[model samples]
Target: MISSFLLPLLLWSIERILKRKQFGWFIVIVTLSLVNNFYFAYYQLLTGLIYFLLELFFVINTIFYQEKVQSNVLSLPHYWH
Candidate 1:
């Protein structure tokens, strides 16, 4: 029952920790959630992914594709390789 309220905070925390690159907490939260219930764990991550994409689109204030791809240019080689 309590999970209903706490789930949003926990799910959003996944985004905060990830946005800041805290992999340790990310793993801990995901593992803890997964251990409790698979359905919840799935929803938590699913919700987090949706929130992340929404935030990504809204937070960026760019008009050109070049601007968006500029920062990622350096990492493209690694991804391609």
Candidate 2:
């Protein structure tokens, strides 16, 4: 029982360490893992899908925005140099 709580906490700490370089993907995986484990082992559905959906949206937005900026940079002359 105690390990169950400790497990997610440990995974969460690891996820935090990787946050800046791979923010959304890590969060999604960790959150989903926690949700699955807790649900299957403890029969608890903690945390709402709304928050997950928001994280997904933010990730998508960030990717799209970055791509747009890259494309704009490519369009400028001498950008490759």
Candidate 3:
């Protein structure tokens, strides 16, 4: 239960310290943790699954939208006086 809350924060801290994006770690850790929850009680498994999906959606959306914005900016023409 505690791991579910802490892993994201741990990943975020690692990314921040390294000054690099770490989506791969985020996906793997979250997926495994959620999958492990299924071995426990039913309620924990259900809530963990829901939370994992929501977090995955949010992370994926942020990555896609951020890339889209970056691409648009890069494609814009530069002006010189």
Judge candidate 1 against the unseen true structure and give its global Cα lDDT, from 0 to 1: 0.70
Higher-lDDT candidate among 2 and 3?
3
* TM-score (C-alpha) between model 3 and the true structure: 0.47
Candidate 2, residues 5-47: lDDT per residue as tens digits? 6445544544454465445544555565565665543332233
Clashes of each: 0, 0, 0
TM-score of each candidate structure, all chains considered together:
0.57, 0.41, 0.47
Best by the lDDT measure: 1
**What lDDT tens digits, residue by residue, belong to model 1 across residues 41-66?**
78988887887777777656443566
All candidates in order of lDDT, best leading = 1, 3, 2
Q: Report the Cα RMSD per candidate.
A: 9.9, 8.2, 7.6
lDDT of 3 by residue, 21-78 (tens): 5566555655566566644334544554566567678878999999999988877765
Give all candidates' CA lDDT scores.
0.70, 0.55, 0.59
Runs of candidate 3 with Cα error greater than 4 angstroms are 1-40, 78-81
Candidate 2 similarity to native, TM-score: 0.41
